[model samples]
Structure formats: structure tokens, C-alpha cells
Target: MNTATHPSESHEKLWDLIKDIKFGMLTHRHATGMMHSCPLTTQNKKLDEDSQLYFFISRKSELASALAADANVNVSYADPGKDSYVSVSGVAAIREDQAKKQALWSAPAKAWFAGGVDDPDLALLAISIDHAEYWDVKESKMVQLAKMAAAAFTGKQPRMGEHKELNLS
Candidate 1:
């Protein structure tokens, strides 16, 4: 299903699709113009009402430089267990928010930044979401396979899930 969500609903819907998915593949353009993707963990424990998402990454990494060169980026989130997938396109930038770093700081992150929130190499990546697409099929794998086989023999497209596209900005 490809449907347009009402402007009011889109914002909330986008958040619902991604709130629990802890990891996302953030893709950005490199200096060579080639797209590069790296897995990053969303530092926020809860998705704020705004579509923007937060991440913690190494300031010295190429990703940090990529964001500096080009803010346009995409973040993909997936949960195969629930058959829910989301792709978010947004502008990304590295921020030096000390309070945010302290609030989002975690023990696992300490392994990478021994200096903790004060680590010189630590950076906060913020994605100002502009658009998002999601596919949500709340069904079991076996059921989905059966549906696919049935649809194939019956010459019908299997209704996979509730898919929606949102223009967030």
C-alpha cells in the first residue's frame, strides 16, 4: 500500500515506525560523490515529537567530514521480526551540544569515547528529517509466504503491509 498520510498524521506516523528500532544505516555522499553508509545507533531513548533523530559518532571519522561537506543524508531502519521498515531522508549536521551528549551518554558509548561526554573525538550527529517512507506488515513469516504463494497462483498481488510516504518538511 502506497498512501499519503495527512500532514498532521505523518509526523506521528513516522515516529511510530522508527521509535523502537535502535539502529539505522545512515547514508551520506562522500567527497568522491559516491554514497557511503554506516550503521549508527540512535542515542535518544525516545523519539521526540519532531522527526529529527540523534546519533553519536566519532568526530574524526569520515562520516563526520561527510556531514560537513553535505548535509543531505538518508537513514534506513528495519525490524524484520515485525516486518517493519523505514527510510528517512534528511539533512545531517554535527552538533556540539554538551547537554544532549550528557543526556544521551551511555555505558556502551564509553567504550568508544573513554573521555566520556568530554571526549574530543565524540560528535553528535543530528538528522533534521524532511521525508520518510515506511512499510509495516504485522504478520508472521510463514503467513507471509503462504500469502505470497496464494497470490502467485491466484494472479493477485499480496497485500504486504501498510505503506505510507510522508513529506515531513
Candidate 2:
């Protein structure tokens, strides 16, 4: 079972867990009923009050076309060194808002979109997060290994650290 947190608190916690993780694996369902994923750099400096995540994608890419057909998506972030993993499910859409593009634009993004925020191929992808879950292990590696070994012998599941689910809907 997962612990529950207040909506705003959960949002903050979720952001805290993923903010430093450089890449999120975004999985989108293709029209042909296959799920495809790609690593996309998260663009938000901070999580929006509306619980949205943004990324810059190529308009000509298959991902763009797949999202147009089905907007539901999942984005997962992991920081193995910290033993933290987060999975966020949401609805995705490509935005054409110029002001937003300018706001999220960064110097590093210029490497891909040389024309900057005005690049024609640049598509702003926004994911309106509805639900998210995270696993954060605070125990030492040795302790975790011992628990795993015990569980293996006893045929019981090992207890990790906190696991929580957040609903933003």
C-alpha cells in the first residue's frame, strides 16, 4: 500500500524527487497500438501550479505524430544513486504558445534548435499530470541487500522505503 499526501504537498514532493534528474523517459502510445519511449530533458525550472511538465520535441518526429493521435502518456524518472524512482501518468499535447517557449528556452536547448525558440521544427510538449507514484529507498545498500536475501529465503517481499501515490486530477 502507498501512503497518501495532500494534493499540494504531493505536487511539491513529486517535484522535489525529480527536479535534479536530468532526463525523463517519456512513453507514448503509437497509433498502431505500440508504446514507444524516448528520453526527453525536462524543461520546467519548477513544477507548474497546474501540475504540468514540458519538453521540447521535433515537430517532424514520430513522437509528435503519435501524441496527436493519443495524448495519454507516462514519464518515468530514476536516480539510482539515491535509490529513487518516479512514474508520472498524464495527458500530453503539443503547444504552440510562443511565450511559453520563450519562458522554457535555455542556452543548452540551442544545440538542438539552432534557430532558438523560433525554430519551425521545435514543438513544445506539455504533459498535464493526473497521477504519479514514486518509490524512494532511504536504507543503506547493505541493509537493502540483507533484507532482499532474507526475503529470498522466507519467500516474502522485502520492505523498502516510502512508496506514495499522488493524484492531481
Candidate 3:
């Protein structure tokens, strides 16, 4: 991906793409320094703003342990139909705010906790994103296929433009 654009503009475009996708994969660095990723739901208090943080796992999953030891994290989202993707980097921490928890809570999430939102084991994971980048590919699949075929004839690799970079610090 071209990294020539201003960081602010890149961040805006990435947030736009992420807003469209709604969900993303959150990655964390384990104590062993290996990275682990899991699908997570995205949420925000404001509709116009990018998700300030993503919420998942209040208790001790491997992801939670990793976050506790090291807050560094990354999240990625892509829309196949739109051919757009975004990656966000940030620090993650457990949030115990009742108001924030109530705001993000849904009945479906209760299934993961025996006492629901009231469970002592329940914890909120908050990822404070530092920066992000995005790729936009609005062309249809047929166009991509044709491009691939043409590239094959030229003995060149086909270009699939869904790529992005984010700084998770």
C-alpha cells in the first residue's frame, strides 16, 4: 500500500472503513511475545465517531491475560463486498465503569457470563486506537477476475488492493 498520504487523512479514511464493517479482529501480544487474534464486536457512544474502544471478555481469557500484561493491540476489519479494509493499533485495558458497560451491553453478550452484566467476572476491554490506514476497492468481483486474467497473460502478479497499516502503540 502507498504510504505517501498524510497520517491524518489516512486515519480518517481508515475510520470510515471501520465504521462500515462494524466488527473486527483484535490482536494481542502474549507474554511469550507471540501475537493472538480473535473476532470482536465494535461499539461506540457516538454514531459519528469511530469506535473509541472495542468491548469483549471481562475475565481471564488468553486475550485478557495478554492485555493485562501488555496493553498493545491491533484490530482489523474488511468488507468483501466493498473491497475496503482497515487496521487499528492501540493499547487495550479492562474497563470497570458500570455506565460504559451498561451502554455496550446487549442480551446476546449475557450468554458468555453466568450473572450477565452483573457477573463479577464480567470485564470490559477497551482499546484506545492510536492510528489507522485503509484501502478502498469499489470494483466488482468480475473486474478483479478480469484484471487477474490480464495479469496472468502478462506473467505478472494480480493486484488485489485490500491492504492497510496501523500503529498499535
What TM-score, computed on C-alpha atoms, does each candidate reach?
0.89, 0.94, 0.75
Q: lDDT of candidate 2 vs native?
A: 0.94
Evaluate model 1: give its lDDT: 0.86
Which stretches of model 3 miss by more than 4 angstroms? Answer: 1-16, 20-22, 45-51, 153-169
> What's the ranking of the predictions by lDDT, best on top?
2, 1, 3
In candidate 3, what are the lDDT values of residues 1-169, reduced to their tens digit?
A: 6553454555466556666666789888877888878888776534224336657586867778778889988888878777776767777878779887887788778788778777888888877777666777766799999998999899998777655555422
52-146 in candidate 1: lDDT tens per residue? 78999998998888788999999999988888999989999888889988999999999889998999999998898888889999777888999
Q: How much lDDT does each candidate structure score?
A: 0.86, 0.94, 0.73
* Candidate 2, poorest ten consecutive residues by summed lDDT: 1-10
Off by over 4 Å in 1: 2-8
lDDT of 3 at 8: 55
TM-score of 3: 0.75
lDDT of 3: 0.73
